[model samples]
Target: MELRLEKFTKRFGDTTVIKDMDLTVGSGEMIALLGPSGCGKSTTLFAVCGIHKMNGGTLHFGDRDVTTVPAQERSVGVVFQNYALYPHMTVEQNIGFPLKIQKLGKAAIRKEVERLSELVQIGELLDRRPAQLSGGQQQRVALARAMIRKPDVLLLDEPLANLDAKLRLEMRSEIRRIQRETGITAILVTHDQVEAMSMCDRIALMKDGKIVQLDTPEQMYSNPRSQFVAGFLGNPPISFLPATAGAEVVLANGQSIARPRDLQASGDLILGIRPEHFGPQHGEGLQGEVIFVEPQGREELIDVRLDGGGDIRSILSAGAPIRQGDRVNWGVATDSILAFAPNGVRV
Candidate 1:
């Protein structure tokens, strides 16, 4: 189903939590609602599930306006981080509980439970209780329960947050596979950019209760609309250098660099560069003093203090013999340079 939210608004007393939020999830397309805590990403998810009444705006599932629909009638399945399940109930009972509430016959419920159990690869553990299962297994059970009713939309609230690194990686692939096979419209709420980048067809990066950048992972990373989006999405985070642009672009260190056309307006702007964008200056570039070098298995992070500017971090191949206290010249890839206005908007 195509889920749409138009001018959706939410609040607590006089405080507005969501402000004219609008988002669209195409039929069978999975999107990730990604942002840090208190950014209203999860609140938007709650609104979709009908747990929070919108103080304004409208909600729709396909052509059906479900703005006023009750939670139970929304046909939305939610999987929480803690894997909410009855500890006393066996896997079979837990998976079939929803069907039982709907008053399906015993035989039909049993068959449906079996199908869901196998679908989630928990068939062999049908008789086991929640206590007997590992975290990953328990998560599988929760997923089965959510899908048993074949909901129109699946909402996952940081579902893998509790798992360890290995398990989280495994579940990321698993969830993507399940969503693709089931062809269900899905929305995942997570603060982890990697999770959103890897799993979703598109990412809705939210900030302060509004969608800031809604685009494919590629576009969001390579062409961020604002400084916040650029800094928030990268793993190592982007580095910023104070710069002045006019007839000649100059860094705080008094180093003159090629001026980007977008900054031709000539004023003070911030030059944003990712660590990986810096490389050994084989030709001409900026000169800095190496403060330290940290080895990261396959790569090395070289921290340099520009002659007259702030700290500059560069990611280089681990094999490079660069060491601390070494003077080195590094140049940035022109294509990788991101210039941002003083107001935080990308120039």
Candidate 2:
């Protein structure tokens, strides 16, 4: 089912947590509401699930206006971060609890429970209790419970946050697979950039009670509309250096880099570069002294202090014979350089 929120607003007391926002989630496409904590991602997810009332605007599930509908009637399934499994009940009972409440026949509930358990690959554990299962198993149970109803929408609230690193990775793929196989419209709320980028078709990067950028993970990373969007999406994060914009962009350290012809902005600007964009100098480029080095498997992260002032980080091959205190010349890929205004807007 397609979900739409028009001019959505949410407030608590005198403070507004979610401003007037509009969003449309396409049928069978999973979109992520991604942002730092306290950025209204959770608030938006709760509103979508009908847990919180919207202060203004309307919400729609397909063609039905569900703005004032109760959560139970919204036909949305929610999987929480903690799994929220019933410790006393066996897996079969837990999975069929919703059907039991709806007065489903015993034989029908048993058949449905078996089908969902196999779908989530927890069929062998049907007799086990939540306490007897691993975190990953418990998560699978939660997913099965949410899907037993075959809801119109699925809302995942950091469903893998409690799992170990290995389990989190495993579940990321599992959730994506299940979501695809089910073909249900879904929304994932997560602060983990990797989770959002890897699982969702598009990411709604939120900040300050509003969406900062809405785009596919690739576009959000490579063609960020603002400095914040660029800095937020990268692994090691993009480096920013204050510089003067003129015929040639002059770095704080007195080095002049040829400004891109498309950049006609004047006055103070910030140069943004990713760590991977810096490479060993072939001839002319920035000069600096290696200040720190850290090994990351096949790659090495190196921090360099510019000759005059300022500092930048670069990722290099672990085999590179560079060490702390060594003077090095590194060139940045011209096409990868991004110029932003002093106010953090891309130039």
Candidate 3:
């Protein structure tokens, strides 16, 4: 079922936690709420689960208005940061606990429990207690438990945060697969950009409890709507160069100045260049002194001080003869630069 939040507002006393937040999750789509701590990503998730009361808003599940729905009646399943599994209960009993509350028959509960355990690949660990299971195995049990209820909407609140880095990487794809296979609309709240970009169909980038951008991973990276979004996405991040208006951008390297056609009149704009876009000089290129060269097995990361005294970086191939104090010619594609305003907003 699709979920919609319209004009959502939440506040504690005078401070607004979420402000006029609006979003939509299509049927079977996984939308991730990504932001740093205190950005209200978790608060928004809690509001969706009815754990936090909204100051004002309307929530709809499909065509039904579930604005005032209670947590249980909302038919939302939640998996928290810490796997909230019962310690004393065996995997079977823990998974069947929800069914017991629903008053299903014993045999039927057993069947449902086994089905979910198999689905999460924990079928063999049904009889084992939570204590005997490893962290990853225990999380699988928790996932199975959440699935047993067959909720209309599934919410994962940083479910992989507790795991080791390697395990976190492994579980993210697994969760995405399960969400797709079950055709359940899912919402994930996380601060890890990689996690959100890798698992979400679309990510809502939030700041101060407000969504600044909502887009696919590629769109967010290649066509960022805001400077914050551009700086927030990608590994190594996007580069910013101090620029001036002199009919066009004048790099101190003696290269001719030319403004992009779209930004001919944009005065004193900062230039955004991705590190990977720098290539060997075709003719006269930006002159820079290589300050440091990091040799990766596949590629080398070269840091250079531009002739204009600004720092710039480049990604070069391995064995590119890049060393400390080596003079290099860096050529940036004409179409690769993005111009941003001084207020950190993309122009």
Candidate 4:
């Protein structure tokens, strides 16, 4: 099912949580709602899934206006981080519970339960109780249960949050595979930018109940529409420095030309640079003193201190040589700088 939110707004007494939020998921597309805490990503998901009532605007699934539909009647399946399973129910029972509610025959429910278990790689554990399964196993069971009903819309609210880092990666790939195989429209809500970027077809960046930007993973990373989006949706995050229009924006050890368009008419603008945009500065880049070097498995994060008291950080190949307080030169071109307004809006 294609879920659509048109001017959807929600309020809690004096607090307006989601304001004029609009989003659409094409059939079989997996869309992720990504943002920092209190950004209203989950609230928007809940409203679309019929779990939370909105104070204003309309919600729909394809042609049907389902803003007023009860959650149970919405044909939406929600998989939460906690697994939300019945402790006493066996795996088969848990997966078939929804079908049981619809008064389906036992044989049909069993068939669906088996199919789901195999799909999630939990077929052998169908006889076990929730307590007997490992974290990853329990997560698979929860996913299977949600899919047994063949729900038109699937809402996953940080479903991988409880797992360890390794397990999160494993399940991340698994979820993407399953979503592709099943071809079900899905909405994933997560605070982890990596998770959202790795899984979803597109991302909706939420901030204080509003969508700051919505785009594909490549676009979100390459050309974030705002400072908040840039800062919130990166692994090392984006580095920000106060810069104004000039012939050469001077740095600690080096300098580069300001984007002519950026310098045309600007106030207090920020020069945003991504960590991976620069490697080793040959000659025409910022000059700085290396302060710290963190070796992260495959790469090194080189931290440099600018003469103007600002810090610049970038990723280097793990094999690169570096010492504490070593002066280094690197390149930062006009295109690498993202200029943002003081209001956090991208200019």
Candidate of highest lDDT = 2
Q: How well does each candidate superpose onto the true structure, as a TM-score?
A: 0.97, 0.97, 0.93, 0.95
lDDT of 1 by residue, 1-347 (tens): 99999999999999998989899999999999999899999899999999998899999999999999999998899998899999889999999999998999999999999998887888899999999999999999999999999998999999999999999999999999999999999999999999999999999999999899999999999999999999999877788887888876788779977776555456888888899887674345889889988898998888899897688788887889898998887777755789888888888
- Score each candidate by Cα lDDT: 0.90, 0.91, 0.85, 0.84
State candidate 4's TM-score: 0.95
Candidates 2 and 4 compared by TM-score, better number: 2
Report the lDDT tens digits of candidate 4 across residue range 225-252.
8888888877887788876555556432
True lDDT of residue 226, candidate 4? 82
lDDT of model 1, residue 181: 90
Off by over 4 Å in 4: 250-267
Please say which candidate is ahead in TM-score: 3 or 4.
4
Model 4: pairs clashing at backbone N, Cα or C within 3 Å: 253-287, 254-287, 281-330
Model 3's TM-score against the true structure = 0.93
* Lowest lDDT block of 10, candidate 4: 251-260
Where does candidate 2 stray beyond 4 Å? 281-284
Candidate 2 lDDT, tens digit per residue, 1-347?
99999999999999999889989999999999999999999999999999999999899999999999999888888999998998899999999998998899999999999999988999899999999999999999999999899998999999989999999999999999999999999999999999999999999999988999999999999888889888889887788888897888889889978776678788898888889887684245899999999999898999989889988889887888988899988887766778888888887
Query: What ranking of all candidate models by TM-score puts the best one first?
Result: 2, 1, 4, 3
Name the runs in model 3 displaced over 4 angstroms: 251-257, 281-284
